[model samples]
Structures are given as C-alpha cells and as structure tokens.
Target: MLPLESRRDMKIYTFENRTIDIRAYSSAGGLFTALAEIVLNKGGVVYGASFDEDWSVVHRRIDNVADICHLRGSKYVFTDINGCFSQVCADLKDGRTVLFSGTPCQIAAVRKKFGYHENILLVEVVCHGAPKKEYWSLYLDELLKNQGKTQDEIASINFRDKTKGWKNYSVCVEFKGGSRFIQNHRDNLYIQAFVHDYTLREGCTKCPFKNPNSKADISMGDFWGIEALAPNIDNNLGTTIAIADTAKGESILDSIACRTYFSVEQVAQYNPAIVKSPSVPLDKPEFDTTVKAEGFHYAAAKFLKPVFDSRDRKMSFRNQLRSFIYRVYSFIKNR
Candidate 1:
C-alpha cells in the first residue's frame, strides 16, 4: 500500500484572478499571490526558496509581501533547506501562521523534522528532480563569463521567465550594469540538460514522494495543459494547477475568491510528476565523466546539442496538435 502521504484526496483548480504587481511570477493563475495573501491576512510568515546573490537556490524567511513575491517562479534546481525547518517551527510555535513551499522531498523532510503544526501550511511543487549544486554553480559561472560580469554584479535571475510566454519559457538574468540576458529554455544548455533529466540527483530517479497522496497541505504546479482544460483561463502569461491535499488545504481554497475547479484525473493526465518519477538520464555517466574531465560547457556542447535538437523538432510537430487539444478541452470545460 502507498504511504498516507502518497494518497490522493485532492481538489484541483485553475487560479485566474491576480493583483497587478504580482503578475510577473504569478503568471500561473496567481496561486502564489493567493497563498501570499492568505499568509499576509493572517499576519503569518512565509518560508520558501529564493536565489542568493551568487545564484544558489536556498530557503529564506519572507515577512512582507515584497519578499514573498520573490518566492514566485521556479528555481529549477535543488534548494538546500539550511535550517528553514527550524525557523518554521519557531515561527509556528510563536503563534504565527507559516506557509512553507518546496519539493516533495523537502516537504517530507520538514514533516519528519517538525511533525505537525496547525499554524503551518505545507505546499509542495511537482518537482522534476534536482541536479547537483556543483552543476548549477558551474553553469552560472559560464553565464557570468558569457555576459562578462562578476557574480557580485548579478541583481536578479529568473529561471522560469515568461517573457516569451509560458510554453516557451526563458531564463532572464539581470546585472548591476543594467544589462540583461534572456534565452529560451531550449537555447540554454543548462535548462536543456535540466529538462531532459540528464543532470538530476540520484534520489530523484527513485523518489518516494511521487505519489498522488502527499504530506503537504497543498500541491502546486504550472498548468502546463491549461489551454486544453480551460482555454478561457489561459492567456500565456501562465496558469497554475493547485491541488488541495488535506482538509486544511481545501478550506483555504474555499476561501480564495477567484478559481475554477478541475477533476483529479484531468490534472493527473497532464502532470505525471504528481504520481511518478521521471526516468534517469541515460547519459548521466557520460555527462558526469565529461563534466568532471573537461567542463560543463564542453560536456554540454558534445552531449546535449543533439538531444535538444531532437526535442525541438518533436515539440514543433506537436505544438499545433497541442493547441487543438487545448481548444477541445476548453470547449468541453465550458459546456
């Protein structure tokens, strides 16, 4: 039998209404905004992942709406907890409501570390596994070199920048020089390898958290297939797919103002990460070997270009069909 955390008693929804300033990262139906507003209204604290000046993903405490807004968007890498659990417990014990978000493994770790707290709300992302921090560090260095900027000059970076729209997301990096670099996921070697699962951590391939039932009060992810399910709701900025896994989670959804309910099967069909782990990257050994002996750039050029090219071609063919499906789903959903 699946563990209790792996069980799926969830209510899915598409979040649409969003406040204006929060639109940047809240593109996916403003789920983060909704969550943030709830925490703020309760005078609670938010604990979520954000990037350091050096571009490493790490968890931090967010007290104000401005800081919580930073927690929007995906880091697309493994984030170290770095005592976030201890802090969350501390806040909850102080009678503050806490909204904690992370990958399912991180969520499980939080559960193991702190047991249960009524004031704490756990939100887990449908993760695609994590790559070693070393790989990301190296990739960032490569970006710095390409941009001719020092790590200290970096002002911000968004891995899931929606400038090109959601389906064709890009990485946008800002520097103190007022310079910005934006490149599509397919064009970026790091994202290419990431999306293909070539550089994921070992535990990810056999992750135990890939069950429909999760320990988190809520589960959230991009509504990747929203066009098919609710065409009227998708405007390309992004749409969010949120699942309330517990009664607490459900209650919070009931209180939120603007949202559209969806079926569990409809959501699961588009997002398998909710129930299954992705296959291990076939070229991980080669990637490891070449990356160790040569470097990230050389290894990526050699091992990843062909893979990315193939994916580009495949997606190109399917884009039209996917569009059709979205229209069909919208028709059905509205009717």
Candidate 2:
C-alpha cells in the first residue's frame, strides 16, 4: 500500500490519461468551468450527485460538459452509495474517463465495487460525516407536518446557502403550490444532530481512505480556517480546498482553469495539525459494530434513536427560545 501520508495534501495525479486536481473554492460557475476544461482538453464524462426534480437524489452523468452546471453547490443531497451505486458502477464499466464526486464512503464503495478502472477518477469531499437516514426522514416528516403538506409537495432543498453564511445557512424547501419554507440550519434539529454522527460507516471512521489509501485522485472540502492561512484569499466569497493526492491529481490541477490554486505547503501551514498528525479514527462506537451486524439498517436504526432523541430535546429547547424571541420582537415592532 502507498504510504498514507504521501497523499495527505492536495497534489496532482494522473488516472486513465486525464489529469485533474481537487480544487479550492470555485464559484458556482467555477465548477462547470473546470469541468469544461477537462472535457475540451481530453473528452470524458463527469459524474456527481445532483438534486432531482422532487429534491431527492440521483447520480448525474454529464457527457456534454455543459450539464455540469446542474451539480454545483455543497448541498447536493444523497451522498450515500446505497441508492445510486449500481448506476455509478455501470458508468465506470463503460470505460469512459469519469469524474466521480461524492463523500469518502460513497467513493470508497464505488472503488470497492468496481475495483480501479483505469479511466475512473474519484474525487471525495472532506466530509464531516453523514446524518442518519431516519433523522432525515423525521426532519422531512416534521417539515411536512408543520406545513400541512405531504412529502410529495416538497420540490427542492438546499442545505448550505452562502448568502446566509453558516448560522443563517438555510434549508430552502419548496412546495408544489410555489410557496417556500426557509428553515435556518439551526431550526433543523434533526439535521444538526445528524451532522454529529453521520459518518456512521464502520470503515469510514477507521477510514482506510482518509489518507493516501483513498483511491480518489483528488479530495475537496471547505478550507475551514482558510482566512488564517491564506489571508490574501477572500474566503468570504467561499473557498473550496483541494488536496491532490497523486501525480494524476497534479495533472488535473494543471488542466483545470479558473481556480486560484494554493500549494500543499500553504494548506499544511494553514492547518498545521492535519500535516502534523495521522488521519484521525472515525471515533464512533456504533460505526464499529454496524458493518458486521446481520442487518446494518436495523442495527443503525436501533442504535441511533437514543442519540437522536437526546439531541431532539436540546433542539426543542433552542427552538422554543427562538420562537419566544421572534414573538417578543414582533410585539415590540407592532406596538
């Protein structure tokens, strides 16, 4: 196995004759701009998650390159491999150069299922982890209940909105009636709780892929604390940090245009601890047991309830406080 640390900071690597780097923040336009560079220089397909018409999840295949415009943003849902694995694997088998973007586990799953197809390039997010499916179900249920609408009435959802920043980061839920419900990230208790334990996959916490062992050529995530490191870069506009893990990864960076690339040394200097240490273990006990369990779904559902319930109470308290504040503000303004 390659020394895991070798792939820690974004470097470049080559896969299936194409080169691309995990990028630092590229604007909504920047994502497509980079993909366009890849397709024009070396014809290939781009695959990533996109929001469906109903705001559900689907794997997107962009052969024309222009279609990449559809998959921009941090909130493209359904990072789990369960729903979209077969389709993704099939595309890999087709032998076209493919850029598969997703959370690490989903990338790992595709790598495991398809093996290393020479033409496939895997790009993973620096994921905080994923929320439990139950939490999402309950959240949507609560939303529907509050709105007096059915699940089908929901049209789209955006989990992260840069216009609002993280605190005001809102989930925009649209309805069939053309009305929209903008729930602040804080208002979505289940989502907040889910973020805490979402990296539930057994192998993920131990994350063989967390380092260079990852099959992906490039890794992408928010350059948290970027301001401290790249004081020159305007993070307020949002930055996507890319860590190229291999030579092919480096080549991709060379190929892509529009992104303001930073050096690995600069990235390490910004996040000294990440450079100083080994990749952290996944750290969740439930994650260790779920994979070996007879039924992972049943086991996860059974084990995660207590954790979610405890969070629910805390969320409820916070919500009440918010409601009280809103009401007081309304009363004063009206008077």
Candidate 3:
C-alpha cells in the first residue's frame, strides 16, 4: 500500500517556551498578513517560490505584504526555486531573516543544508507528497501537444482559480495559438492517477519529513473545518490553520493586526478525522527500492506492472504508462 493511503490519523502539535496552547489562528488572509507583517517589521525579506515568465519556479523576495498575493494558490508540492539546497544554505548563512515556505520535504532539505538558525523561519505546508517532476513535464508536454502548441506558444499558466471553489480548481493555460484552455479538475485523468499515488517520488512513499517535531517555527494548512467553526469567516474564500510551533511563531502572530482569527477548536468541527488521527512516525529509510537504480527493477516492475504492463521494456512500459496517465490527470486537476 502507498504510505499516504494509510488511514492513520496525522498528528499535529503546538509548542511554546511556556504557554500551553501556543496560540493558533484561522483565516487565510490573516495568516499571510501576519507573516508578511512580521517579516517587514524585522526589515527582513520573505523569500519563497513565485511564478516566473516561463511558468517555472524561482525564489522571490517580498518587501511588502501586497506581494503575498503572488504566492496565493501555489501548489504545495512544486516550488518555483532554482538550484538546490546548497544555494539555499548560502543565502541563509548570510544572516538574513528569511521566511522559507515549501512542502515538508523541501523544508527538511533546507534545514538539512543549513541546520537550524534563529533568524530563519521555516513555514511548512501540510503536504501529502509531491509527484515526480518528470511527470509534470510530460503532462505539460502532452497538454501542449493536444492543444497544438509549443513551449514558446504558452503565455502563462494558473493552477488554481480563487473565483472558483477549491474542488473545482481549473488550470488556465494561454496558448500562443491565441487560444485559452481552462481545463476543469474532473476532465484531467493525470491528476486522478497522481492523487491515487501512481507518480509520487519513491522517497515520498516513505517520507522523512512527516514529523510533527519539525524544525519549522510555524506550519500552515487548509482549515478544512473553517465553515463549521468560524461561520463568520468566508469559508468559500479559504482559511489557513496556523499553528505556532515555536516562540518565534507566537511573536510573529502577536505582532500582526488584521482580520479576525480563531483558535484550533474554532475550526475543529470541520475536520474531525485529522483532528483525532494519531501522528505517524517520521523515521524513514535512506532510500526506497522502488525508484532507486540500485534496487531490483524486476521486483519494482512486479508491483507496478499491474497498473500498466510488466514487459521487459527498457524504460519500463508499465511504469511509464502509469506515470503518463497520472501526469495528464494531475496537470488537469491538481496542477
């Protein structure tokens, strides 16, 4: 079975130097505004991934809260950053108050690269896991192929549309063909396969970053129960469940003055499942045999063959087919 498929409840915790609750908040805008406010107050730049002209990933700095809008609806898995952890470590060593946001794995990579720093505030999103980058590339390639357009023909892409509800998020692709394709989530088969864990990184299946004891100061996730608890808050607009994992997180939240926010209980009614589920152990092996080259391809092929075809194909036809279907569906639905 896939790792995430386990019906086990994920554990989330709040820590403080002394306080019990550690102070929680709700409201997506309030959460972002709070984080942005703290960064600006410290004269520190908020460094996170943002979309560039090519629709690829790049790290960007935001000096003002208004710039936070650029990061809204960013996919939890894929980040728009160049280089790897080494580059990120170089930036952190410069001693800037930086807010790094990404999936738990990427955040863990950054922490592994730079170690823990008081000035660095790591904010991790609650992620299931990221799909393979190759899958994404192939999916986009197929999309352009189906649309009769080249990479140069694409103007831009937006994965999530705020105007629409989260379940119906659409992928807006503007083609050089001067045509636009706003594919709905349901029409995309690639997305379905991905959600079903057909294209996740092998490491992700046994991820090391699923730790509630994470080094992040603050962790954020969609407030699944926003409507039921904070009925006053705009549930359709989305809300973030901000948990303070450190004193720095509390300090940051205390400094911001914005829209109304609430405690964890305020939104607990919306998601009893996650609230009651036990946290999984974060310990994981160094590598998974399925995706690693050193592992037996025949054994891996045996498990994946049923999904596609288990022939002695060089590229592994079964795996590739599974990947292709997942990529196409994910690009359309999850984006």
Candidate 4:
C-alpha cells in the first residue's frame, strides 16, 4: 500500500553515457562499483557478495578500489553473510565509513542491527528473491559434468555475461585451462529455474520488503525495458535503475564520475519485483521432485517444454499471417 517513492526527497537515476568495461563486468550499469569506488576513495570499506574459491557466493569485505570488480555482477544464488554483520558493526564503531550492498532482507537486517549509523551507508539490490544454495550447487555440478570439467578445472562463473550486450545476457563459465562456456540466458537452466520460481526460496514467493518499508538509502537494479521506456538513452548494453531514498544516497549517486542522470516513474512496468514478489511457479513441486531425483536438466526438460511450445505456436501464427497477406496481395494484383 506504500507509494513507490514514499519519501518526499527520493530520486531516480540512470547512467547517461556509458561505462564500457564497467557495464561489461556488471549485471547492470556499474553503479555499485562506482558507489564502492567513492566510498573506498574516502577510506571506507565495502561489503557485498562475491564468489569464494568454491564458487559459493558469500559476503566479503574489501577496502581497495581495484577489487570492486570481484563484487560486480548478479549472483542469483544464495549468498552467505558469514558474520560480516559483526564486521560492519566493528567498522562503524571505529568510525570507519562503510558501504554495504545486499538483498533487501540482508539490508533490512543491517538497518535493524546498525540503526541509522552516521558512518554506514546502506544499498540494496532490487532482488527477485534468492534461490537456494543447494539448487545452485546442483546446477553447477550438472554444468561441469556436461562440459567435461571438474571443480578444479573451473576458473570463474558469471551469471550475467554482457558480451552480447546486457539485455539478453549470457551465463559464462571460464575454465582454468583457458576454454570458456558462454550459454545464452534463454538456454541457461539455472536462470530458467530462478525465473520460473522452481529454485527460489519459499519465503521469496511472498517477500516482506516490497516498498515504503525498505531502510536502504539506495536501491539498484537492471533497467530491463529501458529501450522502450527511455529510447534516447538506451545503449542496448547494461543500464542501471537507481532509486535514492535519502540525501546520503543522492550524494553518493552524484559522485559517480560520468553518468547522465534521469528520473523514471514507471520502473515497475519493467522491473515488477521492485513492487511485488514473483509468484511461485505452479509446477515447482514437480520441478523440485524431478530435479532431486533425476537432475537439473531433466527437470528443466520437462518444464521448459511448454516455453518452447509457446514460442513455436507464436511463430507458426506469425508465419501463417504473413502467408495469408501475401496471398491476398497476389489475388488483388491478378484481378
């Protein structure tokens, strides 16, 4: 029931020019990296999710600006906070500046635990609910098995590889031996699981942090439909949609060196998760059972069949319409 930007001073923003390398490494525009860089330049530390050696996403801390790349991109998998809350508290207690970015739930916990600390700035990713870590593990196992690789052979996993541009991003897996597996997002089973709600947590089906309730100073997400919403600024690469809830958030956004600023009111039209939780897929129960017994691919096969079928049906209809129009033109010309 809360308004989108409940605060009178809340503002929206998007990158004007382009962040070339930054956008390439990021899931969206490199706004998080920019914000972290600002904090680091001011002698502050940043806490956010990063992949560990085993590729499990977990919250980590870094004070150096160069390491911000490690924190970029989207990890749909669950991220273990791993006692980082206490570390943030320690930093704040010592009067050190801190920039923390996480899912709404994590940010809410930080806000509750730290309580409007002057030295701490809170940022939250506009999340579509996190999937279970176990699901991600299973998917990774299947991925490595299919690629004829093992845990030791893998170098890195990127859920959002913007090489083909960010709109329809790819899931990239780099091997230690120098080969890479870059699968289109449409074909990525893990993304399908996350998007279709098969792997999302039960609580995420009805998330508690929608709007007018978030304590985060800034909320950032991929502007999915920016091309249609704001065609002039659309680069077909990655563009970030940022909502600044406090003056501090606005100040941090202003510090982003080279970004064009613009406000959007209908962001939810593209990013629905901003205002509501994605409903649990009806087939999730079957999906879970199939995945647990057979594997991720097996479950995906049975479920994704409908998606392919729908696409085929739509294509067939379009083809039929085109043929009909051509025939009609031929008849008129002959007459």
Candidate 5:
C-alpha cells in the first residue's frame, strides 16, 4: 500500500517548450527543460540521468545547458544513483542551489539522506517503474545485432521520440554517422513487454511513493489525457503535468517560461499512478524465470502468447499481500 502523506494536495500545470532540439527521450512540453531553467536561473547545477556507452542510465551533474542537453528524455531502465546523493550534499553544503531530478523513490532517498535542506530542490518524475537493467541490456544487444551495428557506432538512444507525435511516440536511435533508426513503440517487442508490466523492478510493483503528496518540492509526468480535458492545449508534440507539493515548488513554477496552472483533480483523473500503484501482471514471476533460463527474445515470445490468459492478468489482493510479505521476509533474511 502507498503512504497516506502522498495521497492528495497538489497543484497541476501544463508545460511546453519548442525552442530546444527535441530528442527521442524527451517528453512533449519541455518539462525537464523548465526544471533545468530554474537551476540555471539560480546558478545551480542540475543532477539528472544520462545514458552510458553501453546504453545504461547513470546519474550525472551539469552546470551548462549545452552540456546537459542530452538529459532530456526517459531511459526506462534502473538508474545508477551511486555518488549522486553525496554530490548533492557536498554542493548544498557549499551553498549551491541544486536541482536533483529523478523518479519519486530516488528523490525520496535523497530527502532521507539529507533531511530537509533549504538549498536543495527535489523534482520527481511520475514513473511507471524502472525496468530491469539486465533485461534492457540484453534487449539493446539484440537491437544492435539486428541493425548490424557495433556498440561504438551508436551515438544516442531516445525512448520517447516524438517523430510520430506524442501519443504514438517511437524509440529513436542515432549512429555516429548521423543515420537514425526509429521504431514505433507498438512495433517493438521489448517495449511491448515493458508496457505490459513484465520487466519492471520488484520495488515498482509495490511503490511507496506512488502518491500525489511528495517529499520532493515538485512532481512531473506526461499529461496523458490533455486533449480530452483541455481541448485548446496542443498535444501533438506532448504535454507535461507538473504538480507542486511545496510552497517553494509553487513559487518556482510561477517563473517557468511557458506553463498554465490547473486544478489537482485534472491530473488525478488522467494519471491513476498519482493516487495508486499500477497493477502487477500475473505472469511476472514466470516472466522473470523465463528471462533467466532462456533469453529476452524467448521470454518476450512467451509473454506475448496470449492476452486473455488468467496467468497474464493482474494479481489479486491475496496474492499482492503474500508478495509483500515475502519481500519483507526476504529483506530481513538478507540483512
């Protein structure tokens, strides 16, 4: 179950940005850019996730926009948070205004590590969950092999490419020679598995931070149902939903270049992840076991076999409770 403090009390907004060169992973409405602008305006360093050479996501810090331009989009994999918290603490101790952006749990960990620092601004993304690193690493290898490309030839990868518009977004990958490969999410087997809730990390299935009230100053995510609620808003590119959880968050939001504040209910109605955890698929354990015994491709084939099968459906309350108990027991046993 989610923590009660994270249940309600938030201010929503629609944000957009057309100036920067849009990347594959960047969501519509320039939400991250808006947050980066705040750090820049305050002469602060921005801490965000960046992809490593092997396509793994790692936390990084940047002081200039040009250097941090690639930190725009989603990576969809478990991020390496090593050194990020310590760096933020060191910077804040030196009196720097640090904007640390990541998933809700990452922000929560940082908050717990530093306790309430006035100089630190925590911004969490509305997350579906971090997919397993091993699965993603294997999936990328398959893509590279299918394309006949070497790892060194790859320049960048974007999970939220908007070439086909926001709603039908595709994954975009660029090689060093400027050649690009774009795959619609629907056509990608790995993405299909991810969206179906098969490869997600265990912690995400029972997220404690999946609530509106946040320890961070602000929370942001894709404003999914923008077209239905605000007909005037241009969602062709994409729209961002920013929720202010603190006075400082609200104050910083008012200064963003292009944003319009709206009621909290507008966000809750569209994105259920705001109030409750996403349902875990029934075949999750089998999916994990198959991935370990066979390969990602084989496991994906098994996962795609049928949609109506009972084992593929969401877990029941009894199962969820049992899983939680097992997780707690395992944690204690490991300790």
Candidate 6:
C-alpha cells in the first residue's frame, strides 16, 4: 500500500465498537487500547507512554491485560525511551511481537533502531507536539501548592478526564481518599498551552516527520471535526481519526473487531494536523523565558490567551460549512 497521503483509498476510522470500558477511558475512541489488546492477546509486548511515580510521562512496557490500563490515555509532555530502546530490541530479537507506540518522532527513532522488522508494529499518535516535561513538573508543583496537597496525596492524574464528556474533557487529579480536582480545558492552563502550541518543543515547530513522512503502521488522534464528518457516531464521548501507511498497517486496521467508520477525504480537513506540523505561537520564546524565570503558572497566565473557546466554535462552524459544500459538489458531480 502507498503512504496515507499518496493513497486515495487510505483506511481511516473511529473504533466505535471497541470495548465499552476501553472507549470510555481512552483519550479518543479506545483505538490504541483495542489495538494493544490484539497484540497482547497474541502474547506480544506493548510499549507506550505512561505516567511514572512523579507524574512524569515516560514510555513503559505493557505485557499483561491488567497493565494496559496504565498505557491507555494521553500525556502531553515529552517522553524519551532510549533506555528501553535496547529492551525493545531484545524483545524483538527474542521473537516476540512488539507493538511500540509514541509520538511520531519517537516512532521514527524506534523504527530507525530496528530498521524494517516485521514483528515490530510502529504505532504513532497524531502528536500536537510534546511540551517539555520540566514545565509539566512545574505545573504539578503549583497544583500541589495551591491545593495544599502533596504528590503522595494524589492517586492519579488524568490529562484527558472524560467525566464531563469527551469533547469537553477535563483534567482530573484524583486523590487517594476519593476526592478529586477537576478543571475544564477553558480554565486549565496546561491544556490551554498545549492546545495553543505555546508549550511545545522547538522541533515540533518544523517537525520532520509531519505526515506521509512518519511511515508508521498506524497513526491516530482525536477526530477533531467528527460532528461534521461522522455525525451518526458523534456522541460527544470520544472519537479517533486514524490512518494506515503500509499494507501491514491496513491489515492491522482490518483486524480491528470494532465499528470502524469514515474515509480519508472526510478526515483530512477535519484533522490537517496529521499532515501538517503544529504552528508555533509567536510568543513561544517569551513564554519559554518566563517559564524558565518564574514557572509554568506565570508563563501560562501571561501568554496562553484563548477567548472563551471561540476558536473551537468557529472551527466547528467552518467545518460544517465546508462539509456541506463538499456534499453539494459531490451530489452534482455524481448526477
């Protein structure tokens, strides 16, 4: 099969039929978890980004059904797995199927390390650029200080908490005692910085592995314009935009025992980020300076200026209009 961009018949879909629990907890439609299940069921080891003891995002290995939950959600911070690169190499050498997932660049690095191994399935997220882990640490420190809580008092931190619903996903800091802190993206500085691309790494500005370049088996992300693209399945729960680059990629997608839906054409305008690198916010340098001098809190308060999520509303309206015109054009052309 050709690259996702070069091929007109690229396989793209939302894993609507994925297990209910998995879909409910996932960042987007539980596609990764579903895929991970397939590999795990086959006795393969899955490697993915997960939060560590300090709530720092790091890539870890998952081999059992119980451990997949840890690798289930999205972590916006940068993660390096060079330490586990050799471990993955050993896993592959020992004739085990390895499902390695990460941001596009991390996938590229792993793909380079292993060359073209048939047993190694490279799955990359449609990354929005990884923010530096240092900033994430700073935010946690501030959150702890503000709440008068310590890291030990927290049980888990979910960046994509869907209690309010997927489209309006919030950040949830669950304490061990049962009480938790939840904040919507509108009020969440860390999420706003990530969404506005103000906290992303410098390399993400001109990402080399933009679209057709990543060459991973499967690339997935939140189906941003799902309301316009696949309305029937748009439950405001969660949906994923997925694309396959190679024949194996397509095969892996075909193996999914889920209600897959959509076409490549319907997905592109909805999620051009899969094809384009994240644009750098103009104040990123100043934001970085502020962050280094003060902290993520000060920098975010000063720089992350989003006007009441009007951009999301505007983008949705524009997507609906674009889809309407495309439908009209297609109807007339076919007639």
lDDT scores for all predictions? 0.77, 0.55, 0.54, 0.81, 0.77, 0.83
lDDT of model 4 at residue 100? 91
Model 5 scores a C-alpha lDDT of: 0.77
Taking all chains together, the TM-score of candidate 6 against the true structure is 0.87
Error of 4 at 187 (Å): 1.3
lDDT, model 1 = 0.77
Please, what are the lDDT tens digits per residue for candidate 1 over residues 204-297?
8889877564778778777777778878867787777777777677777767734465666777688777777878767778888999898898
Across 175-207, the per-residue lDDT of candidate 3 in tens digits comes to: 765688786654444454454455566666556
Q: Order of candidates by lDDT, top first?
A: 6, 4, 1, 5, 2, 3
Regions of candidate 3 where Cα sits further than 4 Å from its true position:
1-42, 52-54, 58-70, 76-94, 176-178, 257-335
The true-versus-predicted C-alpha distance at residue 255 of model 5, in Å, is 2.0
TM-score to true structure, per model: 0.87, 0.63, 0.62, 0.90, 0.84, 0.87
Least accurate stretch of 10 residues (summed lDDT) in model 1?
A: 1-10
| lDDT at position 79, candidate 6 | 90
lDDT of 2 by residue, 1-335 (tens): 12135434444221111222212113221343464446535767776767665445566666775565456556533455565566656665665577777776677777777665677777776655554443455456656777898877876566665456533366677777799887666545444444545433334345445544456666665555556655675435455566565556656655652244456556545443223322323544554365345334344445566666787898999999999999999999999
Tens-place lDDT digits, model 6, residues 78-179 = 998888888897898889999999999998898888866889888899977889888899999998998989998899988888888998989999999898
Give candidate 5 regions above 4 Å deviation.
Answer: 1-9, 18-25, 257-262, 307-335
Residue 206 CA error for candidate 2 (Å)? Answer: 3.1
Q: What lDDT is obtained when candidate 4 is compared to the true structure? A: 0.81
Off by over 4 Å in 2: 1-33, 40-43, 76-95, 113-116, 166-168, 176-178, 198-204, 257-335
| Native-to-model Cα distance after best TM-score fit, residue 72 in candidate 6, in Å | 0.4
| Residue 15 lDDT in candidate 6 | 68
**Model 4 clash pairs?**
16-260
